[model samples]
Target: MHGSPTGGMPNQGAATHGLAALLLLADSRLPAGGHAHSGGAEEACRAGLITGADDLSRFLRGRLATAGRVAAALAWSACSASASWELLDAEADARIASPAQRQASRTQGRLLVRTARRIWPSATLNDLAKALPEGSHHPIALGVAAQAAGCTPDQAAMAAAYTSVTGAATAAVRLLGLDPVTVHRVLAELPYDSVIAEQHDWSALPAHAAPALDLLAEQHLRTEVRLFVS
Candidate 1:
């Protein structure tokens, strides 16, 4: 299955180079619609909960532990079994309580799948497109994309977990006028790698909840003026 998906052996060198593929999928400039969303950092900032780098670090850690963990697990699961993507989509929807968050996930998922189709066309992705025309949740699409890109499940999980912070870290630079360099430094110092290490069991995906974040998302949607979509 690691090969061309036609029962042929994959190139050894290319398989070993999966790290590069993972990076490309995880990069912020992949045109996957991640840039348009803040993963709730924007709302938290406006609510006076996040004022600077210190607060951002705490927020990122909490997010990594809860929402990020669930996303990474779903991404890894999708890569492990692309056929079960529909069930995984249901699980993602069940995990997300807020309607706004669910919409944001589907929106980002649609964009990522569309972009991935041009770069790494595959029957799996095409089937996914047909099955979930509105688009699967973001992590589900990301996992399938990782599979198409020849990445392992663990690599996909790491990419998913990393984006949980990097997206918000970038947003903080814009919203708070925080020093980009220092914000990145804060990102570098976070224990995201540890979180990824603990996410090996796709079947036992964490269902941790952040009610405050859910409330914030609802509040963000109601706000008259906002910069980010979610």
Candidate 2:
């Protein structure tokens, strides 16, 4: 039974393989529909709230503390309990007040699942597809995908936090024509490890509110001319 043909535990290299899987999910080029959404950066810019690197830094930091933290918590919960997809999906809906934001999340979630199915097949993901035919929320879908990829809940949470800021950071670079290096330096300096460390359970998901961010999403939807979708 040392090397049984009947699917035994993974080899010692599995941890290294899991780290690679985690990086793949965190990568911006994963075809998860992330490019189209600015996480509200475009709207903030249009309102003159985020004109330069300084404003961008403040905006991204606020987002990371509020929405980003919430996403990481939900993703941690979902990855930790793959059977609770429905519950987590409802929770995501309840957390997001704005209609535009909800639509944006579902759109991204749908795209993530579409790509994840091809990359990392799993019964949980298939079930999620059936549960929300349109799509589960992005964080929930991401959590399930992370579990399938053999990542721990903490790793999933970290990825959630990382993507939350990086998406907006990249969008700022494109919309403002700011020096990409400087913008990235700002991103590189974020206290992500501390933020991730604070996320311990679903109950403490840090629902810090930023009403301006929600309002920005609403206004961004009405803009007659804009670059990013949300």
Candidate 3:
């Protein structure tokens, strides 16, 4: 029999391990309380901003370019940073203009942290929980979780970018009953590469504003009846 790279054992590359971690972190099935929030899709749907697949596509594209880019940069920064959780949380606060959006981010962050700590059990995640008793931003928690799972900064960024719009896309399917295949096609076309760029400076993370989304979030908070949390 032919011997493998490591003395007859199958070789497992770091990329393969990272890919698994990335998929788990990005999966909607994770008990991270992500199912409750729509990433502003509920509001957008009620506001008639996303009436169909084409409108949803445009909305998701815009979100991917703006909020998704910011989230990817923040997650990459957090994954790369060893002890800058507090600073990163503050930076997230500054970048999120809407109070409603900020609340949603922190809510998701706290839930993600709770789930990640139980699953990964890393000192980094512990420090993150300690640093922000209130809760770190969602992207920050995601980055730390990725690190604990043996994922690289790039994988963290990709996961962050992926989630930024996926929740909303799923929400749209529920809200408007749009074709799942068509919605997924839109998701497949997202320019993830453009959002998941390398960022060396944590302080200079992308702050692409989504005023419409922000307004939608604020409006959603005020609505008496809603299907999703945000």
Per-residue lDDT of candidate 3, residues 1-230 (tens digit):
11111233334665576678889999999999999999899988888888999999999999999999999999998888779688889999999999999999999999999999888778888889999988899999999888887688899999999999999999999989999999999999988989888888767888999999999999999999998989
* lDDT on C-alpha atoms for all candidate structures: 0.83, 0.81, 0.89
User: Order the candidates by lDDT, highest first — what do you get?
Assistant: 3, 1, 2
Q: Please name the candidate that would achieve the greatest lDDT relative to the true structure.
A: 3
Model 2 misplaced regions, further than 4 Å: 1-11, 197-204
lDDT of 2 by residue, 55-147 (tens): 998998888888888888877876777565676788788888888988998999999988988788777778888888898889887887887
Decide which is better by TM-score, 1 or 3: 3
- Between candidates 1 and 2, which one is better according to TM-score? 1
Error of 2 at 216 (Å): 0.6
Off by over 4 Å in 3: 1-13
lDDT of 1 by residue, 91-174 (tens): 888899989889988999998999988888888889889889998999889988898888888888888888878888888889
